[model samples]
Target: MARYVVIGGGIVGLATAHRILLDRPDAEVTVLEKEPRLAAHQTGRNSGVIHAGVYYRPGSLKARLCAAGSRSMVEFCAENDIPVRVCGKLIVATEEDELPRLRALHERAVANGLPVRLVSPAEASEHEPALRCVEALHVASTGIVDFTQVSRALAGRAEQAGARIRLWARVTGIVTRGGEQVVRTTAGEVVADVLVNCAGLHADRVARLAGVTPSASIVPFRGEYYELRPERRDLVRGLIYPVPDPRFPFLGVHLTRMIDGGVHAGPNAVLALAREGYSWGRVDPRAVVELVGHPGLWRLARRHLRYGLTEVRRSLSRRRFARSLARLVPELTERDLLPAPAGVRAQAVTADGALVDDFLVVAGPRQVHVLNAPSPAATSSLEIARHVVSRLPTDRSPG
Candidate 1:
């Protein structure tokens, strides 16, 4: 049986290990996570909305995987007795200028083979009574669930399948000798015939350690959120989103009713000082120096300077965030907003400063590194695992 070592214990990492065992039951699998607990980073910090393949371009990997994974996720939750809800989502267009963009999004959704329809203002209000929109795209298949719970369930299933997971085992070094991989970690040394890199925020660095240069560098972006007070939660019936700007990858501030019954709003994206920087007070000098040295960072900043400034303003001011969310639900006010934890997205940017919009997986001898997987990654975790497992090397060549 081949010995396999997988890095990171987030949902994708756990799912990958589980998929590997399903495909090769006799293989020995070990997962190493730096954090004391699983899903400590992006997996645990997201808004937990299972995307319905609405915004992706036609014929893309994200489109295909997200569409399939949504079904699989709901099925998985049902099988494991986890709570999940297909609450549906509305992408609202509040102004006349946004109507065309909303219509284009609807066309894209249809082209991607999703069940979506364009609804008028009255129809939109019927779905979300407090919402104020000129038009909306209703995606009935969109759903909500706690991804951290999903990650825990995945770890349990993988462990039951004879996979060993070691918490607080941080990988520090990797070496290749005679077709085997020698991995050095905080916990101890591990030897494997194959290695899989699912390190979310530090994926590119992990790829470099394994002697495989990634296609892009990982730049962290902080997405801050606020939860609606219990009294204001009723303002949001389900999920309310804005017509995203075509220039950026982020979906602008909106409202979501989480599976746990609380309503969350505003995840405006801004530059993060560190890979795991969730708040402005938390800063890493090394991360800042590295970001300053990267040419892509400068280029990206120059391109989105105005938008970046606006996001910074929103981040510093609760009133600004409230005003942005008010575009979707007119009843939302600053008083109803309460502080919520933030998540940092691991986005990949190329040398030319173009943000990677699709799933990026780079391959090496007996190794595969998932370079970029931001939003929808949690929604598409199982499918991503299958994709990664299929790409594992079959040869006995040295890693």
Candidate 2:
């Protein structure tokens, strides 16, 4: 049996391990996670939106996997008896300038083969009664579920499938000995015929440790959010998003009625001080220094200085954040908003300053690394697992 070692215990890692066992039941599979529990970081902290393939470039991995993953995820949830709802979403264009982008996004959505339509303000209001928009793209496939629950279910099923998941096993070093990978971790040493890196925020560093030169460095961006006051939650029926700024990867501030019956809003993206930085107070000097030294970060800043500054300002001011949200729902105000937990996105920035807009997976000798998987990664986790596992050598012979 081939021994497989997977790094990180987020949904992707667990899903990958599960996929491997499904293909090779007799294979030895082990998952290493630095955290005491699974999904401690990005997997647990996201907005929990199962994205449709609306915003990504039509031919990109995101478009393909997300479009497929949406259906697969819902099916998995149903089979596992997990609570999931296809709540749908509205990408609203509140201003005249946003109309063109909205139209373009509609075209892209159609090209990507999604069941999306351009709706008039009246049509949008029928979906979200309080919404005020000139035009909107109604994506029916969009859904909501607590991903932490999904990760737990994945871990349980993988464990049941004979996969061993070791928590608190932080990888320290990696070396190849006798044609097999020897991974040194906090808990102990592990030997494997294949190594899979799904470390999410620290994926690039892990790739380097495994002797893979990643095309990009992970730059953390904190997405700050706020929840609607209980009474005000009625303003949002499902999900209401603004037409994204095409220049950046972030989808602008809007409102989402989570599966739990509360409403969330305003996840403005800003530079995070640490790889796991969720709030401004959680700063790490080393991470800041690394960001300062990265040429791509500087280039990215230069290109989006105004946009970055605006995000920072919004992060600092509740009133400004509320105003941004008000663009979609005119009835919303500062009093209707309450602070919510934030999530940090590990975005890949190239040395040339280009943001990797697609899911990036790199292959090395007996190793596979997911270097960039932000946003729809949770939505695309299952397909990503299938895609990655399919690339491994099919030979069942021992190393």
Residue 366 lDDT in model 1?
Answer: 84
Candidate 2 lDDT tens digits, 186-281: 999999999999999999989889888899999999999999999888898999999998888999887888879988896899999999999999
* Model 1 lDDT, residue 97, Cα: 98
lDDT of 2 at 226: 96
Q: What is the TM-score of each candidate against the true structure?
A: 0.99, 0.98
lDDT agreement of model 1 with the native: 0.93
lDDT of all predictions: 0.93, 0.92
User: What number of backbone clashes does candidate 1 have, counting pairs of residues 3 or more apart or in separate chains?
Assistant: 0
- Please give, for residues 1-399, the per-residue lDDT of candidate 1 as tens digits: 889999999999999999998998888999999999999999999999999999998888899999999999999999999899998999999999998899999999999999999999899889899999888999999999999999999999889999999999999999987789899999999999999999999999888899888879999999999999999899998999999997788999989999999998979999999999999998999899979888888999999999999999999999999999988888888999999999999999988889999999877788989999998999999999999998987545543
